[model samples]
Target: MDGARLDQFDRKILSLLQADGRLTNNDLSERVNLSPSQCSRRRQRLEDDGFIKGYRAVLDRDRLGFPLVNVISVTLATHNRDNAQRFADLVAKLPEVQEAHALTGEMDYILKVVTPDLKSLADFVNGVLLPHEAVQHVKTAIVLQTLKETSALPL
Candidate 1:
């Protein structure tokens, strides 16, 4: 469905779900002032229409033994389609790479990587990234503290 077609109920459902994906239909309905059946149908429709991609449990990286987080700027050797595709494919297979983005600035791509420790981060960058034929330059910045990090979107 088009975004413009989303009603207030739909927006509330999305907001509630984003805050807590594990909320049951009964609970969600109560919170949104809708019947359980209505809530369920609306949720299913939202999912079917691709508003809700999927659900996942958000994990604490530090508790999960991945305390180190680094943001890396990557510059490619060439700007050709083949090299970009190859880099994307390689990044997709890497478990340490939590996020990657193609940028508009000097760097070709930026990557958010997480690892258990400094040694592991070093190993990933030196062993995996530098050895790749597509990679020309890489600069990394370690995250000391996160003031605010969230996935919630304002409705």
Candidate 2:
């Protein structure tokens, strides 16, 4: 639903769910000061209306063997729908590329990539990204420290 149509209770429900998606209906009702049935109906409505997407557990990359994070900027060989589509097709197959964004600036795209180590990162950049016909230049910066990382959106 649109922001204009969301009541205070709806906003609270969204804010609380954003903080913790696993909140049970009973728990959410208690926190939001609403009846359990009301909470359930509202939440279901939100999901039905495409407000709440499907949820998944957030994994720890470091413990899972992918510790290195890199922010890579890409300049495509050409600025055309075909080239952009080709680049999009390439990134879609790469599991290491966690996030990809088409941008408007000096660079055509920015990628958030994760790898196990320096050698693996090098192999990915050299063997995969650079060899792609659509890529003209690739610049990667290894993340030494992450101050804050979250997927939660502000209500």
Candidate 3:
């Protein structure tokens, strides 16, 4: 639903869900000052309208044996739909690629990658990304520190 259609309760529900997706209807209702049934219906409507996508647990990268995060800038070998599609398809199959976005700047695309170590990151860049036909230039920068990272939006 559009932002204009969301009332206070709806906004509260969205905010609460963003903070803790595992919150039960009883707990959510208590926080939002609504009955559990009303809360459940509102939540269902929110999900049906696509405001709330599927829920997932945020995993710890360090605990999962992935400690290195890298920002990679990729330039296509040729500027064409086929090349872009090939690159997209290649990244879609790679589990190390956390996020990828096509951009309008000097770089054709930017990727957020997580790896176990520097050697793994290098192997991915040299063996996988650079060897691809769609890729021309690849620049990578390791993240030294994460000052801020969040998935929640301001409602």
Candidate 4:
């Protein structure tokens, strides 16, 4: 549904869901001041309309043995559709790459990579990224600390 179509109830539902995706229909209904069935139907509509993509549990990287996080800037050899698509496809297959974004700047793409250690990050950059035909240059910066990190959007 369009943004104009979303009422206060819809907005509240979205806000609550963003904070806690595991909230039950009854709880969400009470928060939004709607009946459970109404809440469920609205939630279903939100999902079908692509506003809510899917639910997933947020995991702690340090606890999961992936403490090292690196932001990598990549420059492609050629700025062509084929090269860009190839690079994107390769990155999608890499489990270490948590996030990748193509940009309109000097660097072709920026990647957020998480690994168990510095050696693993170095190996990924040297072995996989540098060896790619499309990759021209790669610059990496390790994260010292994270002040804040969240996937929630301001509705």
Candidate 5:
């Protein structure tokens, strides 16, 4: 598909699903003013078209004992696609790396990490990160407070 052409109904369905993905088909149908079967078909089409990737239950990080959040800036040894993809693949395997971005600036990539405490973060930087051949430098900023956190994407 070139791009997902979203209509009003698609937008509404997406808004409701982002808030609560576990909503029953009947309940969602009622909310969107569509019959259950029609709503199901639309939802299925959306999934197949790649608009709705997957439904998942949100988990509490604090309750899960992962209380620390850190934003890490990393500079790579090179700016080639192979080097970037290699770093990205390594980042994908690290559970603590929640988000990673390739940017057009001094740094190669920025990573948002979540761990239990400073000790774990130290271990990750020393044991896991510094040892990487592609990684040139890393700087970390510990989050004192979180102003906002949301997964909703504007339609």
Candidate 6:
């Protein structure tokens, strides 16, 4: 995809924004060594070019009763297009399946999931995932601790 190439100023802007998305234009400008108007214009251009897609508040999953986090690897019966799409649609409707990706090798898909506890996770597997017609097998690995979890993209 052809897009605007990032220069040093753009990289600085991204670095500052990645840390604190809610920074005021004035604050951001000061941090990035640009005038308020210039910073505002640059940020808007970044958004228009799809460099800065959107901003969101990161919430603690534990506070929402979804402390448990795990990665689920799914293997499908076949590599056909229909089966892959069916699997994707099925995973989309399941709230517990936070993110899904069609992958390579033995595992056809990988999912990032969050739930209340191990029992709840088991229930989801038995009640929902296993029942899906396209899913051949599913393997899950629980996350005991997170070493690093940041959405910042290196410029």
TM-score of each: 0.97, 0.97, 0.98, 0.98, 0.93, 0.93
Model 1 CA deviation exceeding 4 Å by range: none
- Model 2 deviation from native, Cα RMSD in Å: 0.8
Highest lDDT among the candidates is held by which one? 3
What's the lDDT of the predicted structure labeled candidate 3?
A: 0.96
Per-residue lDDT over 42-90 for candidate 1, one digit per residue giving the tens place of the 0 to 100 score: 9999999999999999998999999998999999999999999999999
Report the error of model 1 at residue 67, Å.
0.3
lDDT of 2 by residue, 1-155 (tens): 58889999999999999888899999999999999999999999999999999878899999999999999999999999999999999999999999999999899999999999999999999999999999999999999999999988787
Better candidate number, 2 or 4, judged by lDDT: 2
lDDT of 4 by residue, 1-155 (tens): 69889999999999999999999999998898999999999999999999999999999889999999999999999989999999999999999999999988789899999989999998999999999999999999999999989888878
lDDT for each residue of candidate 3 in 1-155, tens digit (9 for 90 to 100): 69899999999999999999999999999999999999999999999999998899999999999999999999999999999999999999999999999999899999999999999999999999999999999999999999987889989
For TM-score, candidate 2 versus 5, the one ahead is: 2
Error of 3 at 39 (Å): 0.3
Per-model lDDT: 0.95, 0.95, 0.96, 0.95, 0.88, 0.86
Locate the minimum summed-lDDT window of 10 residues in model 2: 50-59
Off by over 4 Å in 6: 1-4
Clashing pairs in 6: none
Which residue pairs collide, candidate 4?
none
Model 2 clash tally, residue pairs: 0
Whole-structure CA lDDT of model 1: 0.95
